[model samples]
Target: MQARSVAGEAARNLVTGTTRALWWALAFVVLVGGLAVADARVLVRVWQDADAFRSAGAAVQTLASEREQVVDGTRCQALSGVAGLTGAGALRPGAPVRAASMPSSDLTVWEVTPGVLDLLTTTARPVRTATGTTTGGLWLADDLAAALGASAGDELVIDDGRVRVAGVYTWPDDGRDRVLAYAAVVAVPATGTFERCWAGAWPVDDDAAGLLYSATSPGADDLRLGQLNSTRGSGYDLSGLVDARPTAVAPAAAAAVGLVLGYLAVRTRRLELASALHARVPKPFLTWQHLLEAGCWLAAALSVTAAATGVAALVGSPGPYLGTWATAGMAAGTGAAATLIGTLVGVLTTREKHLFRYFKER
Candidate 1:
């Protein structure tokens, strides 16, 4: 009963004495830590987006640089041989088909096989006819649909054939000025000679190059072959940026806040701690009691920090940034460590003091 009474008295003294300091510490940690976390999250998201944009730009640039070489002449017959050798199966003739009143754009009408839509990235829908067979109609790129003021299920005349717009699609190497439309090979009139052939093959392979060389007509040296090389060495370098500022600032700020709060707490209860020790209180018990007090402050600080982060996420435009688990874990760990350090400092200062001298001076 005596021990219990002593413990209760110590706990009450700790709480009442340090309440103001605890509040100030909690507010400071929450405000600073919340801002740091939010900033880190935003930076990571933006860097990822920027890297993706850069990759897309690189692919477009590679395709544009090589387009002139592969698409030179009006009639390139060797395209069929090139297609067969590169495992693209067969080459189909394609031409630009447009409506009369439509504004001019760089649009190409391609005649493709049945599963060509499956090979390419498209939003095509399968239509089941009366015979129970599924067939694909004309498909337009997103920009092309916008330009024609058309949507899926709308009919548009391409060449002499009226076809339904199946869906909108995007190509990885497609430029802003380029749009593509597709139809079944059987639906379009055969032009006998193909103006261009769309074939898929990695241009860097020696086997592909050898096949392209043999396929070329003896006199048609103008038939050029271009390959898209989007492979890059290294992506974005986030190491330097992440490590430089936040890592140093967060821990330091936490430590500073902890030290100040801890000093204030110790100063307020100096006499109480002295009295308790002089009353035959065990050093370990006193230390544990002070630790419990520090823990309460630490818990409040963490709760406030969490709430602040959540509120920032809810109200901020573009939303609050959430970083990796490691980043968040490190931040929490640092705060805890700083708080513990501050608590130990206070405890040790009390243990080493000369209680009799303190009373004599008083």
Candidate 2:
């Protein structure tokens, strides 16, 4: 009860106490809270990018006779087994056909199997402005359409036949499309009878990552995932964003600050503690008083961080704030607690057997 009373009194002293070592410990608590909040904010943005990239980064694979690559039905079946592939398809490629609108325009045509462009080109967020229908015609890229001096209604006369231009889809020509912007998809036969199978998946796909990291024993076939388009992704690091693993940095730094303050709070005041002990004051009371002093300031710092969190949420930050608080706060809290513990431990463990040591040191 004496320790409790002393602690209670010291807790009151914190507000009126001079701003010094204990205040610095409180500052560290504030630092911990701020770090947690910052980490939460950054993680939120990264997750948004991750969700978008999960689809936009994937480009279908290719298997074409033009490359002298032959793929059979049995091999195509393997694509079906891939759990990561959200969409898979087989499209035939025709020889380069000359567009009637622009005689010099050598356009590639794909014999699309009606409706699946989104699934095939998973890794892109281009403004896919599609217009009209091919009615078994071609789907021209908006950019390609401009180049050919053609529109949705106009027919594209090729060597195979006069195909009616259906709709057009405009997406970026980044490595994710795996198709050419200057290409058209028509619903007719191409020169090639065999079709190339493509999968809508990227390396970040959890299905792919799961399979790769499975604890299952060896002898599993390695699924080779590749993209057809060979260009950089749409200005984002699709798979290499660093997470908050280094969040400990802030707390570790706070701990160093706490340690210095703890030294000041305890070592500089040993004589006072000795005088109290001589006056028949219990060592535990002195220890608790110092701890309470530390706690009051640290708790105040935590309060400031909490206030900041409220401000962030009010300003429309989608939170993981609680998570950051727990992570960073716990780390910083331990260090701050250790400061008090270390200070008190010093008092209890000192070799001073009498009040004479205090008087002599003074």
Candidate 3:
């Protein structure tokens, strides 16, 4: 009952010609929403790309630098570098191993054993049966497939292994890096010497270089000198990708500040909300009205902002920026509150017609 009464009072306060104000407020909300959506999309993409690039960069850094470290006789745990038909040996430090090499004029291929293949999913389902029933054999990046006009079942040949289209995948940097090719990685053949083609790591001779382990890397640090690190390159920079929480939260904070200021503005009006006690209406009523207006506007703004953020998350490029949703919510709440306060302040400073006459007579 109280809610309805308050709402009824608020409805009465709605000015008929203030369509302009309402429109202006709505326009502001829309603008803020659009920005938030754009920001979120950009933020998501940037974070993803940053993660990918960082992973790639880290891999490049690791491979490039590790060579120097190992050459100095530091005895990093080593694995084989033999390029089998699948080119597994040429596996980059932080990328997926394809079942066969991709047909690439620019990219090169090498071979590794089943031990080297690092399947993303815990259940690494095989692409084919021994009888060969056309169980998609080609593994391509989602971005790569979109780029190269290729689909599942497309036969791609690069080094030695023959691979059919198995599945399409997407990495964080797939769009930005322009890397499209098949990675041929075979699971351990049923009957191999080690029961796996890709030999991961065993504390072998330090001089050898297949897959090396070092103490500095995240996973590698856990492995003692004697035990080999089994985890393969996940084709992403996990550390960089997962740490986007901080970036995502920053926009929310800014929006919050905007909301706070908006509340103050609404209550203070253009005159003097500080003098509400001197006005015709009680201070409580004034404050209530302000709260109601603030709440409504804030709700509207937040809704728009959330939509914007979601859009941004999907479409925007990778980078650090304020997300659209957070921006909208904060701005709307603050704007509404401030407007309420400002109007109330102005009202407080004004004298009623009767009061003005009384004072004049006095």
RMSD of each: 9.4, 8.3, 11.4
Instruction: Please report the TM-score between candidate 1 and the true structure.
Output: 0.57
Runs of candidate 3 with Cα error greater than 4 angstroms are 1-5, 15-21, 27-35, 51-116, 119-185, 189-279, 316-362
Residue pairs clashing, model 2: 55-122, 56-123, 56-124, 57-123, 133-166, 134-137, 134-166
lDDT of 2 by residue, 1-362 (tens): 56559856676656666325355555564555566566545555554555555544433444333343233323343354576655544466656788667777578776644324544334333234335432366777667877876676677777667966665565564545446456776654222323454555544353443332121123423333345553534233433553344543655665665666565666666776677777777777777777767666666665676666445433443335555345445545655665666666656754346567767877
Tens digit per residue, CA lDDT, model 1, 144-194: 566777666677775577877665554344232232333222223322432
Q: Each model's C-alpha lDDT?
A: 0.48, 0.54, 0.39
Please identify model 1 stretches exceeding 4 Å from their true place: 1-28, 31-35, 38-45, 48-94, 100-106, 109-143, 152-155, 160-235, 244-249, 310-322, 325-329, 351-362
Error of 3 at 152 (Å): 6.6
lDDT of candidate 3 over 225-254, digit per residue (tens): 211111224234434443443444444544
Cα distance off (Å), candidate 2, residue 49 = 9.5
> Model 1 lDDT vs. the true structure?
0.48
User: How do all models score by TM-score?
Assistant: 0.57, 0.55, 0.45
Give the number of the best model, judged by TM-score.
1
Instruction: Record all residue pairs in model 1 with backbone atoms less than 3 Å apart, i.e. clashing.
Output: none
- Residue 94 of model 1 has an lDDT of 55
The local lDDT score (0 to 100) that residue 41 gets in candidate 1 is 57
In terms of lDDT, model 2 sits at 0.54
Clashes of 1: 0
